[model samples]
Target: MARPRTPLLSPDRIRDAALTLIDAQGLAALSMRRLADTLGVQPSSLYSHYATKDEVLDAVANRVVREVDTSGFARGWRDGLLIWARSYHSVLVAHPNCAPVIASGTQRREQFLEMANSVHGGLVGAGWPARRATEISGAVKYLVIGAASTPFGSGFADDVQVYLDRYPHLSQAHRLRHEANRIDHDSFELGLTSLIRGLEPGPGQTE
Candidate 1:
Protein backbone atom coordinates (compact mmCIF):
# COMPACT_ATOMS: atom_id res chain seq x y z
CA MET A 1 0.00 0.00 0.00
CA ALA A 2 1.43 3.33 -1.06
CA ARG A 3 1.92 5.49 2.00
CA PRO A 4 -0.90 8.00 2.17
CA ARG A 5 0.50 11.32 0.97
CA THR A 6 -1.29 13.15 3.78
CA PRO A 7 -0.99 12.43 7.45
CA LEU A 8 -4.13 11.09 9.07
CA LEU A 9 -4.01 13.86 11.68
CA SER A 10 -4.44 17.58 11.26
CA PRO A 11 -5.19 20.50 13.58
CA ASP A 12 -8.72 20.91 12.28
CA ARG A 13 -9.43 17.24 12.66
CA ILE A 14 -8.04 17.23 16.17
CA ARG A 15 -10.02 20.30 17.18
CA ASP A 16 -13.25 18.95 15.74
CA ALA A 17 -12.81 15.60 17.42
CA ALA A 18 -11.99 17.24 20.73
CA LEU A 19 -15.11 19.37 20.53
CA THR A 20 -17.30 16.40 19.71
CA LEU A 21 -15.96 14.47 22.66
CA ILE A 22 -16.45 17.41 25.00
CA ASP A 23 -19.93 18.10 23.70
CA ALA A 24 -21.08 14.55 24.28
CA GLN A 25 -19.06 13.35 27.26
CA GLY A 26 -17.96 16.67 28.70
CA LEU A 27 -14.54 18.17 29.50
CA ALA A 28 -13.62 15.53 32.06
CA ALA A 29 -14.02 12.78 29.51
CA LEU A 30 -11.36 14.26 27.27
CA SER A 31 -7.99 12.55 27.63
CA MET A 32 -5.16 12.04 25.22
CA ARG A 33 -5.67 8.30 25.32
CA ARG A 34 -9.43 8.51 24.88
CA LEU A 35 -9.10 11.06 22.15
CA ALA A 36 -6.66 8.81 20.34
CA ASP A 37 -9.07 5.93 20.68
CA THR A 38 -11.88 8.12 19.46
CA LEU A 39 -9.79 9.13 16.46
CA GLY A 40 -8.49 5.60 15.87
CA VAL A 41 -4.95 6.93 16.04
CA GLN A 42 -2.10 6.32 18.43
CA PRO A 43 -1.87 8.69 21.35
CA SER A 44 1.45 9.96 20.03
CA SER A 45 -0.25 11.23 16.93
CA LEU A 46 -2.21 13.79 18.94
CA TYR A 47 0.99 15.03 20.54
CA SER A 48 2.34 15.91 17.11
CA HIS A 49 -0.65 18.16 16.42
CA TYR A 50 -1.12 19.37 19.97
CA ALA A 51 1.35 19.57 22.80
CA THR A 52 -1.17 18.79 25.51
CA LYS A 53 -4.87 18.34 26.19
CA ASP A 54 -5.11 21.96 27.29
CA GLU A 55 -3.92 23.08 23.88
CA VAL A 56 -6.62 20.98 22.26
CA LEU A 57 -9.25 22.45 24.55
CA ASP A 58 -7.95 25.92 23.70
CA ALA A 59 -8.50 25.13 20.06
CA VAL A 60 -12.07 24.16 20.83
CA ALA A 61 -12.61 27.41 22.69
CA ASN A 62 -11.22 29.29 19.71
CA ARG A 63 -13.68 27.52 17.47
CA VAL A 64 -16.56 28.61 19.65
CA VAL A 65 -15.37 32.21 19.97
CA ARG A 66 -14.84 32.43 16.23
CA GLU A 67 -18.55 31.83 15.71
CA VAL A 68 -19.62 34.93 17.69
CA ASP A 69 -20.69 37.79 15.42
CA THR A 70 -18.89 40.98 16.37
CA SER A 71 -19.85 42.73 13.11
CA GLY A 72 -22.98 44.16 14.69
CA PHE A 73 -20.78 46.94 16.04
CA ALA A 74 -21.11 48.62 12.67
CA ARG A 75 -24.66 49.57 13.60
CA GLY A 76 -23.72 51.24 16.91
CA TRP A 77 -22.72 50.12 20.40
CA ARG A 78 -26.21 49.41 21.74
CA ASP A 79 -27.39 47.37 18.79
CA GLY A 80 -24.00 45.80 18.36
CA LEU A 81 -23.79 44.81 22.01
CA LEU A 82 -27.29 43.35 22.02
CA ILE A 83 -26.43 41.30 18.96
CA TRP A 84 -23.15 40.24 20.49
CA ALA A 85 -24.80 39.16 23.74
CA ARG A 86 -27.45 37.19 21.88
CA SER A 87 -24.89 35.55 19.65
CA TYR A 88 -22.68 34.65 22.58
CA HIS A 89 -25.62 33.26 24.50
CA SER A 90 -26.77 31.17 21.54
CA VAL A 91 -23.32 29.68 20.99
CA LEU A 92 -22.89 28.81 24.67
CA VAL A 93 -26.34 27.28 24.84
CA ALA A 94 -25.55 25.04 21.90
CA HIS A 95 -22.37 23.84 23.58
CA PRO A 96 -23.34 23.81 27.20
CA ASN A 97 -20.55 21.41 27.98
CA CYS A 98 -18.01 23.97 26.88
CA ALA A 99 -19.43 26.67 29.14
CA PRO A 100 -16.80 26.27 31.84
CA VAL A 101 -13.93 26.70 29.44
CA ILE A 102 -15.66 29.56 27.64
CA ALA A 103 -16.60 31.33 30.87
CA SER A 104 -13.23 30.95 32.58
CA GLY A 105 -12.46 34.62 31.68
CA THR A 106 -8.74 34.00 31.76
CA GLN A 107 -8.14 32.86 28.22
CA ARG A 108 -5.42 34.38 26.09
CA ARG A 109 -6.71 32.57 23.04
CA GLU A 110 -6.57 34.63 19.86
CA GLN A 111 -10.25 34.56 19.00
CA PHE A 112 -11.40 35.23 22.57
CA LEU A 113 -9.08 38.16 23.00
CA GLU A 114 -10.21 39.49 19.66
CA MET A 115 -13.83 39.28 20.70
CA ALA A 116 -13.07 41.18 23.90
CA ASN A 117 -11.17 43.81 21.98
CA SER A 118 -14.04 44.35 19.60
CA VAL A 119 -16.50 44.91 22.42
CA HIS A 120 -14.27 47.33 24.26
CA GLY A 121 -13.44 49.22 21.10
CA GLY A 122 -17.05 49.54 20.10
CA LEU A 123 -18.01 50.91 23.50
CA VAL A 124 -15.14 53.37 23.60
CA GLY A 125 -15.79 54.48 20.08
CA ALA A 126 -19.38 55.12 21.02
CA GLY A 127 -18.19 57.56 23.73
CA TRP A 128 -17.94 55.32 26.79
CA PRO A 129 -14.84 55.97 28.85
CA ALA A 130 -12.15 53.32 28.76
CA ARG A 131 -12.79 52.28 32.35
CA ARG A 132 -16.54 52.06 31.89
CA ALA A 133 -16.07 50.22 28.63
CA THR A 134 -14.08 47.52 30.39
CA GLU A 135 -16.74 47.25 33.06
CA ILE A 136 -19.46 46.91 30.46
CA SER A 137 -17.55 44.24 28.63
CA GLY A 138 -17.08 42.22 31.81
CA ALA A 139 -20.62 42.83 33.01
CA VAL A 140 -22.11 41.68 29.75
CA LYS A 141 -19.85 38.63 29.80
CA TYR A 142 -21.10 37.71 33.28
CA LEU A 143 -24.70 38.18 32.21
CA VAL A 144 -24.36 35.91 29.22
CA ILE A 145 -22.41 33.31 31.15
CA GLY A 146 -24.92 33.29 33.96
CA ALA A 147 -27.86 32.95 31.61
CA ALA A 148 -26.25 30.04 29.80
CA SER A 149 -24.89 28.40 32.95
CA THR A 150 -27.93 26.20 33.16
CA PRO A 151 -31.44 25.69 31.91
CA PHE A 152 -33.32 28.13 34.10
CA GLY A 153 -36.77 26.60 33.92
CA SER A 154 -35.51 23.02 34.08
CA GLY A 155 -33.90 23.65 37.41
CA PHE A 156 -37.27 23.53 39.08
CA ALA A 157 -38.81 20.21 40.09
CA ASP A 158 -41.41 18.89 37.68
CA ASP A 159 -43.88 17.84 40.36
CA VAL A 160 -46.31 20.64 41.14
CA GLN A 161 -46.64 19.42 44.72
CA VAL A 162 -42.94 20.01 45.27
CA TYR A 163 -43.60 23.73 45.26
CA LEU A 164 -47.20 23.91 46.43
CA ASP A 165 -46.70 22.33 49.86
CA ARG A 166 -43.82 24.49 51.07
CA TYR A 167 -43.67 27.21 48.44
CA PRO A 168 -47.07 28.68 47.67
CA HIS A 169 -45.33 31.33 45.56
CA LEU A 170 -44.05 28.69 43.22
CA SER A 171 -47.30 26.95 42.31
CA GLN A 172 -46.61 27.39 38.62
CA ALA A 173 -42.90 26.72 38.99
CA HIS A 174 -43.43 23.06 38.23
CA ARG A 175 -44.55 23.92 34.74
CA LEU A 176 -41.36 25.81 34.06
CA ARG A 177 -39.37 22.72 33.11
CA HIS A 178 -42.04 21.63 30.67
CA GLU A 179 -41.56 24.92 28.88
CA ALA A 180 -37.86 25.21 29.60
CA ASN A 181 -36.96 26.05 26.06
CA ARG A 182 -39.27 28.97 25.57
CA ILE A 183 -39.02 30.26 29.11
CA ASP A 184 -35.25 30.16 29.13
CA HIS A 185 -35.06 31.90 25.76
CA ASP A 186 -37.61 34.56 26.65
CA SER A 187 -36.01 35.07 30.04
CA PHE A 188 -32.61 35.56 28.45
CA GLU A 189 -34.04 38.10 26.04
CA LEU A 190 -35.77 39.98 28.81
CA GLY A 191 -32.61 40.13 30.88
CA LEU A 192 -30.49 41.06 27.91
CA THR A 193 -32.79 43.89 26.89
CA SER A 194 -33.09 45.23 30.41
CA LEU A 195 -29.37 45.03 31.01
CA ILE A 196 -28.54 46.81 27.78
CA ARG A 197 -31.07 49.49 28.51
CA GLY A 198 -29.72 50.01 32.00
CA LEU A 199 -26.24 50.30 30.61
CA GLU A 200 -27.37 52.87 28.11
CA PRO A 201 -25.92 56.34 28.60
CA GLY A 202 -28.13 58.88 30.34
CA PRO A 203 -28.55 62.58 29.71
CA GLY A 204 -25.34 64.49 30.43
CA GLN A 205 -23.64 61.25 31.39
CA THR A 206 -19.92 61.80 30.80
CA GLU A 207 -16.61 60.28 31.66
Candidate 2:
Protein backbone atom coordinates (compact mmCIF):
# COMPACT_ATOMS: atom_id res chain seq x y z
CA MET A 1 0.00 0.00 0.00
CA ALA A 2 1.20 3.54 -0.74
CA ARG A 3 0.29 4.93 2.68
CA PRO A 4 -2.10 4.11 5.50
CA ARG A 5 -5.01 6.50 6.02
CA THR A 6 -4.01 7.10 9.64
CA PRO A 7 -1.29 6.20 12.07
CA LEU A 8 -1.44 2.60 13.28
CA LEU A 9 -1.48 3.68 16.92
CA SER A 10 -3.48 6.87 16.97
CA PRO A 11 -5.15 7.92 20.22
CA ASP A 12 -8.68 7.64 18.84
CA ARG A 13 -8.06 4.17 17.46
CA ILE A 14 -6.41 3.13 20.70
CA ARG A 15 -9.36 4.27 22.75
CA ASP A 16 -11.80 2.51 20.44
CA ALA A 17 -9.94 -0.77 20.68
CA ALA A 18 -9.63 -0.46 24.44
CA LEU A 19 -13.34 0.29 24.74
CA THR A 20 -14.31 -2.81 22.83
CA LEU A 21 -12.11 -4.89 25.11
CA ILE A 22 -13.65 -3.23 28.16
CA ASP A 23 -17.20 -3.75 26.93
CA ALA A 24 -16.63 -7.46 26.44
CA GLN A 25 -14.08 -8.43 29.08
CA GLY A 26 -14.46 -5.97 31.97
CA LEU A 27 -11.84 -3.39 33.03
CA ALA A 28 -9.59 -5.80 34.92
CA ALA A 29 -8.73 -7.73 31.77
CA LEU A 30 -7.16 -4.69 30.05
CA SER A 31 -3.44 -4.18 29.74
CA MET A 32 -1.02 -2.54 27.33
CA ARG A 33 0.21 -5.91 26.21
CA ARG A 34 -3.28 -7.23 25.79
CA LEU A 35 -4.36 -4.19 23.80
CA ALA A 36 -1.29 -4.21 21.60
CA ASP A 37 -1.73 -7.91 20.90
CA THR A 38 -5.32 -7.22 19.99
CA LEU A 39 -4.29 -4.30 17.77
CA GLY A 40 -1.46 -6.15 16.05
CA VAL A 41 1.02 -3.53 17.18
CA GLN A 42 3.96 -3.58 19.52
CA PRO A 43 3.19 -2.69 23.10
CA SER A 44 5.75 0.15 22.88
CA SER A 45 3.68 1.74 20.15
CA LEU A 46 0.85 2.16 22.62
CA TYR A 47 3.07 4.22 24.93
CA SER A 48 3.59 6.72 22.14
CA HIS A 49 -0.15 7.44 22.34
CA TYR A 50 -1.01 6.58 25.96
CA ALA A 51 1.71 6.33 28.58
CA THR A 52 -0.49 4.46 31.06
CA LYS A 53 -3.64 2.40 31.28
CA ASP A 54 -5.39 5.18 33.21
CA GLU A 55 -5.16 7.49 30.20
CA VAL A 56 -6.81 4.89 28.03
CA LEU A 57 -9.48 4.30 30.64
CA ASP A 58 -10.10 8.02 30.87
CA ALA A 59 -10.76 8.17 27.16
CA VAL A 60 -13.13 5.25 27.39
CA ALA A 61 -14.96 6.85 30.29
CA ASN A 62 -15.24 10.18 28.52
CA ARG A 63 -16.41 8.43 25.38
CA VAL A 64 -19.70 7.69 27.15
CA VAL A 65 -20.17 11.34 28.16
CA ARG A 66 -19.10 12.58 24.74
CA GLU A 67 -22.03 10.66 23.32
CA VAL A 68 -24.56 12.64 25.40
CA ASP A 69 -26.22 15.68 23.77
CA THR A 70 -25.91 18.71 26.04
CA SER A 71 -27.61 20.89 23.46
CA GLY A 72 -30.94 19.85 24.89
CA PHE A 73 -30.30 22.41 27.64
CA ALA A 74 -30.97 25.15 25.11
CA ARG A 75 -34.71 24.48 25.19
CA GLY A 76 -35.02 25.50 28.90
CA TRP A 77 -33.57 24.28 32.20
CA ARG A 78 -36.29 21.77 33.14
CA ASP A 79 -36.59 20.33 29.67
CA GLY A 80 -32.84 20.49 29.34
CA LEU A 81 -32.36 18.49 32.52
CA LEU A 82 -34.85 15.87 31.39
CA ILE A 83 -33.29 15.47 27.96
CA TRP A 84 -29.75 15.25 29.32
CA ALA A 85 -30.89 12.71 31.92
CA ARG A 86 -32.41 10.56 29.18
CA SER A 87 -29.26 10.81 27.08
CA TYR A 88 -27.04 9.90 30.02
CA HIS A 89 -29.26 6.95 30.90
CA SER A 90 -29.18 5.65 27.33
CA VAL A 91 -25.39 5.66 27.10
CA LEU A 92 -24.79 4.03 30.51
CA VAL A 93 -27.43 1.35 29.98
CA ALA A 94 -25.73 0.39 26.71
CA HIS A 95 -22.39 0.05 28.49
CA PRO A 96 -23.25 -0.90 32.03
CA ASN A 97 -19.81 -2.39 32.53
CA CYS A 98 -18.18 1.01 31.96
CA ALA A 99 -20.12 2.69 34.77
CA PRO A 100 -17.27 2.41 37.26
CA VAL A 101 -14.87 4.18 34.95
CA ILE A 102 -17.14 7.18 34.82
CA ALA A 103 -18.04 6.82 38.48
CA SER A 104 -14.37 6.95 39.42
CA GLY A 105 -14.27 10.52 38.10
CA THR A 106 -11.13 10.13 36.01
CA GLN A 107 -12.66 11.58 32.90
CA ARG A 108 -10.80 13.47 30.18
CA ARG A 109 -10.48 16.99 31.58
CA GLU A 110 -11.65 18.94 28.57
CA GLN A 111 -14.83 17.05 27.81
CA PHE A 112 -15.91 16.94 31.45
CA LEU A 113 -15.34 20.66 31.86
CA GLU A 114 -17.27 21.42 28.71
CA MET A 115 -20.19 19.34 29.93
CA ALA A 116 -20.21 21.00 33.35
CA ASN A 117 -20.03 24.48 31.87
CA SER A 118 -22.97 23.82 29.60
CA VAL A 119 -25.12 22.52 32.42
CA HIS A 120 -24.24 25.42 34.71
CA GLY A 121 -24.76 28.00 31.98
CA GLY A 122 -28.06 26.52 30.93
CA LEU A 123 -29.40 26.55 34.48
CA VAL A 124 -28.25 30.09 35.17
CA GLY A 125 -29.78 31.30 31.96
CA ALA A 126 -33.01 29.59 32.87
CA GLY A 127 -33.19 31.65 36.14
CA TRP A 128 -31.43 29.48 38.71
CA PRO A 129 -29.09 31.30 41.04
CA ALA A 130 -25.43 30.38 40.68
CA ARG A 131 -25.00 28.34 43.84
CA ARG A 132 -28.35 26.59 43.41
CA ALA A 133 -27.56 25.79 39.80
CA THR A 134 -24.31 24.11 40.79
CA GLU A 135 -26.07 22.09 43.48
CA ILE A 136 -28.91 21.07 41.21
CA SER A 137 -26.53 19.99 38.45
CA GLY A 138 -24.54 17.91 40.92
CA ALA A 139 -27.67 16.24 42.25
CA VAL A 140 -28.86 15.45 38.75
CA LYS A 141 -25.52 13.91 37.84
CA TYR A 142 -25.59 11.57 40.84
CA LEU A 143 -29.22 10.62 40.30
CA VAL A 144 -28.71 9.78 36.64
CA ILE A 145 -25.56 7.79 37.35
CA GLY A 146 -27.14 6.02 40.30
CA ALA A 147 -30.11 5.05 38.18
CA ALA A 148 -27.82 3.79 35.46
CA SER A 149 -25.83 1.54 37.79
CA THR A 150 -28.76 0.15 39.74
CA PRO A 151 -29.05 -3.62 39.35
CA PHE A 152 -32.11 -4.90 37.52
CA GLY A 153 -32.95 -7.26 40.33
CA SER A 154 -33.83 -6.16 43.83
CA GLY A 155 -31.51 -8.91 45.15
CA PHE A 156 -34.62 -10.53 46.61
CA ALA A 157 -35.32 -12.57 43.52
CA ASP A 158 -33.81 -15.72 45.03
CA ASP A 159 -36.63 -15.81 47.57
CA VAL A 160 -38.79 -13.10 46.15
CA GLN A 161 -42.05 -14.48 47.44
CA VAL A 162 -40.82 -14.81 51.02
CA TYR A 163 -39.11 -11.44 50.89
CA LEU A 164 -42.20 -9.79 49.46
CA ASP A 165 -44.31 -11.15 52.25
CA ARG A 166 -42.09 -9.54 54.88
CA TYR A 167 -41.86 -6.11 53.17
CA PRO A 168 -45.34 -4.89 52.36
CA HIS A 169 -44.06 -1.79 50.51
CA LEU A 170 -41.70 -3.87 48.38
CA SER A 171 -44.51 -6.31 47.73
CA GLN A 172 -46.57 -3.51 46.27
CA ALA A 173 -43.66 -2.56 43.98
CA HIS A 174 -42.97 -6.18 43.06
CA ARG A 175 -46.42 -6.56 41.64
CA LEU A 176 -45.55 -4.08 38.89
CA ARG A 177 -42.61 -6.14 37.64
CA HIS A 178 -44.89 -9.06 36.78
CA GLU A 179 -45.74 -7.20 33.58
CA ALA A 180 -42.13 -6.65 32.52
CA ASN A 181 -38.86 -8.47 32.18
CA ARG A 182 -36.63 -5.44 32.86
CA ILE A 183 -36.50 -2.00 34.40
CA ASP A 184 -38.90 0.08 32.38
CA HIS A 185 -38.42 3.71 31.23
CA ASP A 186 -41.67 4.77 32.90
CA SER A 187 -40.18 4.18 36.35
CA PHE A 188 -37.14 6.25 35.57
CA GLU A 189 -39.23 9.05 34.11
CA LEU A 190 -41.37 9.15 37.20
CA GLY A 191 -38.31 9.59 39.39
CA LEU A 192 -36.75 12.10 37.05
CA THR A 193 -39.92 14.18 37.04
CA SER A 194 -40.21 14.13 40.80
CA LEU A 195 -36.56 15.14 41.17
CA ILE A 196 -36.74 18.06 38.76
CA ARG A 197 -40.02 19.13 40.20
CA GLY A 198 -38.59 19.16 43.71
CA LEU A 199 -35.87 21.50 42.55
CA GLU A 200 -38.55 24.02 41.69
CA PRO A 201 -38.46 27.24 43.71
CA GLY A 202 -40.79 27.40 46.68
CA PRO A 203 -42.64 30.35 48.25
CA GLY A 204 -40.45 33.38 49.00
CA GLN A 205 -37.70 32.00 46.76
CA THR A 206 -36.57 34.44 44.07
CA GLU A 207 -33.47 34.26 41.94
Candidate 3:
Protein backbone atom coordinates (compact mmCIF):
# COMPACT_ATOMS: atom_id res chain seq x y z
CA MET A 1 0.00 0.00 0.00
CA ALA A 2 1.26 3.53 -0.88
CA ARG A 3 0.98 6.51 1.46
CA PRO A 4 -0.60 9.81 0.45
CA ARG A 5 1.69 12.75 -0.33
CA THR A 6 1.32 16.42 0.55
CA PRO A 7 3.44 19.49 0.14
CA LEU A 8 2.74 23.20 0.46
CA LEU A 9 3.06 25.09 -2.85
CA SER A 10 3.28 28.81 -3.33
CA PRO A 11 4.39 30.91 -6.28
CA ASP A 12 7.95 31.04 -5.03
CA ARG A 13 7.95 27.35 -4.22
CA ILE A 14 6.65 26.53 -7.66
CA ARG A 15 9.29 28.73 -9.24
CA ASP A 16 12.06 27.09 -7.21
CA ALA A 17 10.82 23.68 -8.20
CA ALA A 18 10.66 24.71 -11.83
CA LEU A 19 14.21 26.07 -11.67
CA THR A 20 15.49 22.84 -10.22
CA LEU A 21 13.74 20.85 -12.94
CA ILE A 22 15.10 23.12 -15.65
CA ASP A 23 18.59 22.91 -14.22
CA ALA A 24 18.41 19.13 -14.25
CA GLN A 25 16.50 18.48 -17.50
CA GLY A 26 16.90 21.63 -19.60
CA LEU A 27 14.29 24.32 -20.30
CA ALA A 28 12.30 22.34 -22.85
CA ALA A 29 11.42 19.80 -20.16
CA LEU A 30 9.64 22.31 -17.93
CA SER A 31 5.84 22.37 -17.93
CA MET A 32 3.05 23.13 -15.52
CA ARG A 33 2.05 19.48 -15.15
CA ARG A 34 5.65 18.46 -14.46
CA LEU A 35 6.05 21.18 -11.87
CA ALA A 36 2.73 20.37 -10.24
CA ASP A 37 3.61 16.69 -10.08
CA THR A 38 6.97 17.50 -8.57
CA LEU A 39 5.33 19.64 -5.94
CA GLY A 40 2.50 17.19 -5.34
CA VAL A 41 -0.10 19.71 -6.46
CA GLN A 42 -2.68 19.68 -9.22
CA PRO A 43 -1.78 21.26 -12.57
CA SER A 44 -4.54 23.81 -12.08
CA SER A 45 -2.93 24.92 -8.87
CA LEU A 46 -0.01 26.46 -10.79
CA TYR A 47 -2.40 28.74 -12.66
CA SER A 48 -3.41 30.27 -9.36
CA HIS A 49 0.13 31.62 -9.15
CA TYR A 50 1.36 31.91 -12.75
CA ALA A 51 -1.13 32.63 -15.49
CA THR A 52 1.01 30.91 -18.12
CA LYS A 53 4.19 28.94 -18.58
CA ASP A 54 5.86 32.12 -19.82
CA GLU A 55 5.06 33.75 -16.49
CA VAL A 56 6.71 30.89 -14.69
CA LEU A 57 9.73 31.18 -16.95
CA ASP A 58 9.93 34.88 -16.21
CA ALA A 59 9.93 34.13 -12.52
CA VAL A 60 12.69 31.58 -12.98
CA ALA A 61 14.87 34.06 -14.84
CA ASN A 62 14.31 36.66 -12.13
CA ARG A 63 15.18 34.14 -9.46
CA VAL A 64 18.47 33.35 -11.17
CA VAL A 65 19.36 37.02 -11.59
CA ARG A 66 18.44 37.77 -7.97
CA GLU A 67 21.03 35.22 -6.85
CA VAL A 68 23.77 37.61 -7.98
CA ASP A 69 25.34 39.63 -5.17
CA THR A 70 25.22 43.27 -6.28
CA SER A 71 26.32 44.64 -2.90
CA GLY A 72 29.99 44.81 -3.87
CA PHE A 73 29.26 47.28 -6.66
CA ALA A 74 29.12 50.17 -4.17
CA ARG A 75 32.85 50.80 -4.56
CA GLY A 76 32.80 52.85 -7.81
CA TRP A 77 31.87 52.75 -11.48
CA ARG A 78 34.74 50.56 -12.61
CA ASP A 79 34.15 48.07 -9.82
CA GLY A 80 30.42 48.29 -10.44
CA LEU A 81 30.72 47.33 -14.11
CA LEU A 82 33.06 44.45 -13.29
CA ILE A 83 30.75 43.13 -10.59
CA TRP A 84 27.65 43.48 -12.77
CA ALA A 85 29.14 41.73 -15.80
CA ARG A 86 30.73 38.91 -13.80
CA SER A 87 27.57 38.45 -11.75
CA TYR A 88 25.46 38.18 -14.88
CA HIS A 89 27.93 35.80 -16.50
CA SER A 90 28.06 33.58 -13.40
CA VAL A 91 24.28 33.39 -13.07
CA LEU A 92 23.70 32.63 -16.76
CA VAL A 93 26.39 29.95 -16.86
CA ALA A 94 24.92 28.28 -13.76
CA HIS A 95 21.62 27.75 -15.60
CA PRO A 96 22.56 27.18 -19.22
CA ASN A 97 19.07 25.88 -19.98
CA CYS A 98 17.50 29.13 -18.83
CA ALA A 99 19.85 31.32 -20.89
CA PRO A 100 17.82 31.03 -24.09
CA VAL A 101 14.57 31.80 -22.30
CA ILE A 102 16.28 34.65 -20.48
CA ALA A 103 17.63 36.07 -23.73
CA SER A 104 14.13 35.90 -25.22
CA GLY A 105 11.78 36.80 -22.36
CA THR A 106 13.92 38.98 -20.10
CA GLN A 107 11.92 42.14 -20.78
CA ARG A 108 8.71 40.68 -19.36
CA ARG A 109 9.95 41.00 -15.78
CA GLU A 110 10.10 44.13 -13.64
CA GLN A 111 13.24 42.94 -11.86
CA PHE A 112 15.08 43.00 -15.16
CA LEU A 113 14.19 46.63 -15.61
CA GLU A 114 15.22 47.42 -12.05
CA MET A 115 18.63 45.80 -12.53
CA ALA A 116 19.14 47.71 -15.76
CA ASN A 117 18.21 50.97 -14.06
CA SER A 118 20.62 50.28 -11.24
CA VAL A 119 23.47 49.65 -13.66
CA HIS A 120 22.60 52.75 -15.63
CA GLY A 121 22.55 54.86 -12.50
CA GLY A 122 25.90 53.56 -11.37
CA LEU A 123 27.47 54.20 -14.76
CA VAL A 124 26.00 57.68 -15.02
CA GLY A 125 27.26 58.52 -11.57
CA ALA A 126 30.72 57.37 -12.62
CA GLY A 127 31.01 60.28 -15.11
CA TRP A 128 29.82 58.48 -18.19
CA PRO A 129 27.23 60.27 -20.32
CA ALA A 130 23.75 58.74 -20.08
CA ARG A 131 23.68 57.64 -23.70
CA ARG A 132 27.17 56.14 -23.60
CA ALA A 133 26.50 54.31 -20.39
CA THR A 134 23.32 52.78 -21.76
CA GLU A 135 24.98 51.83 -25.02
CA ILE A 136 27.97 50.22 -23.33
CA SER A 137 25.75 48.31 -20.94
CA GLY A 138 23.67 46.98 -23.81
CA ALA A 139 26.78 45.99 -25.75
CA VAL A 140 28.31 44.17 -22.79
CA LYS A 141 25.03 42.36 -22.10
CA TYR A 142 24.68 41.19 -25.70
CA LEU A 143 28.30 40.04 -25.71
CA VAL A 144 27.80 37.97 -22.57
CA ILE A 145 24.58 36.44 -23.86
CA GLY A 146 26.13 35.70 -27.23
CA ALA A 147 29.20 34.06 -25.73
CA ALA A 148 27.21 31.97 -23.27
CA SER A 149 24.81 30.68 -25.92
CA THR A 150 27.53 29.40 -28.25
CA PRO A 151 26.86 25.72 -28.97
CA PHE A 152 29.51 23.26 -27.82
CA GLY A 153 29.38 19.98 -29.73
CA SER A 154 31.78 17.78 -31.61
CA GLY A 155 30.25 18.80 -34.93
CA PHE A 156 30.33 22.49 -34.18
CA ALA A 157 33.89 22.36 -32.90
CA ASP A 158 35.04 20.44 -35.98
CA ASP A 159 33.28 22.88 -38.26
CA VAL A 160 34.88 25.86 -36.56
CA GLN A 161 38.35 24.32 -36.68
CA VAL A 162 37.95 23.48 -40.36
CA TYR A 163 36.87 27.03 -41.15
CA LEU A 164 39.78 28.48 -39.24
CA ASP A 165 42.19 26.12 -40.98
CA ARG A 166 41.26 27.61 -44.35
CA TYR A 167 42.19 31.13 -43.28
CA PRO A 168 45.91 31.07 -42.62
CA HIS A 169 46.27 34.72 -41.59
CA LEU A 170 43.14 34.69 -39.46
CA SER A 171 44.19 31.42 -37.89
CA GLN A 172 47.62 32.79 -37.04
CA ALA A 173 46.18 35.96 -35.51
CA HIS A 174 43.50 34.16 -33.52
CA ARG A 175 45.21 31.10 -32.11
CA LEU A 176 43.06 28.77 -30.06
CA ARG A 177 45.60 27.89 -27.40
CA HIS A 178 43.58 26.19 -24.66
CA GLU A 179 45.40 27.91 -21.82
CA ALA A 180 45.31 31.32 -23.50
CA ASN A 181 41.66 31.08 -24.56
CA ARG A 182 40.36 29.68 -21.31
CA ILE A 183 38.25 32.26 -19.45
CA ASP A 184 36.60 31.66 -16.14
CA HIS A 185 34.57 34.14 -14.06
CA ASP A 186 37.64 36.28 -13.41
CA SER A 187 38.39 36.54 -17.11
CA PHE A 188 35.18 38.46 -17.61
CA GLU A 189 36.39 41.01 -15.09
CA LEU A 190 39.44 41.75 -17.27
CA GLY A 191 37.19 42.41 -20.28
CA LEU A 192 34.91 44.67 -18.25
CA THR A 193 37.89 46.57 -16.89
CA SER A 194 39.37 47.03 -20.36
CA LEU A 195 36.11 48.37 -21.74
CA ILE A 196 35.62 50.76 -18.83
CA ARG A 197 39.22 51.92 -19.02
CA GLY A 198 38.79 52.74 -22.70
CA LEU A 199 35.65 54.70 -21.86
CA GLU A 200 37.16 56.60 -18.96
CA PRO A 201 37.80 60.31 -19.36
CA GLY A 202 41.38 61.33 -20.13
CA PRO A 203 43.34 63.57 -17.80
CA GLY A 204 41.74 67.06 -17.37
CA GLN A 205 38.49 65.99 -19.03
CA THR A 206 35.15 67.12 -17.57
CA GLU A 207 32.31 64.73 -16.74
Winner by lDDT: 1
Between candidates 1 and 2, the TM-score winner: 1
Worst ten-residue run, lDDT, model 1? Answer: 198-207
Q: List the RMSD of every prediction in angstroms.
A: 2.9, 4.1, 4.4
Report how far off residue 92 is in candidate 1 (Å). 1.0
Tens-digit per-residue lDDT, 107-135, candidate 2: 34567778888888888877788898888
Candidate 3 at 75: error in angstroms?
1.9
> What's the CA error at residue 56 for candidate 2, in Å?
0.4
Which candidate ranks first by TM-score, i.e. highest? Answer: 1
How many backbone clashes are present in model 1? Answer: 0
* Deviation from native of the Cα of residue 193 in model 1, angstroms: 0.6
TM-score of each: 0.87, 0.80, 0.76
lDDT of 3 at 38: 95
Kindly provide the TM-score of model 2 when superposed on the true structure, using C-alpha atoms: 0.80
Q: Answer with 2 or 3, whichever has the higher TM-score.
A: 2
RMSD of model 2 against the true structure: 4.1
Q: All candidates' lDDT scores?
A: 0.83, 0.77, 0.73
Model 3: which residue pairs collide? Answer: none
Residue-pair clash count for candidate 3: 0
- Candidate 3 per-residue C-alpha lDDT over 36-86 given as tens digits, one digit per residue, 9 for 90 to 100: 899887888778788998888888888887776555447876677777877
Deviating ranges (above 4 Å) for candidate 3 = 1-7, 151-193, 200-207
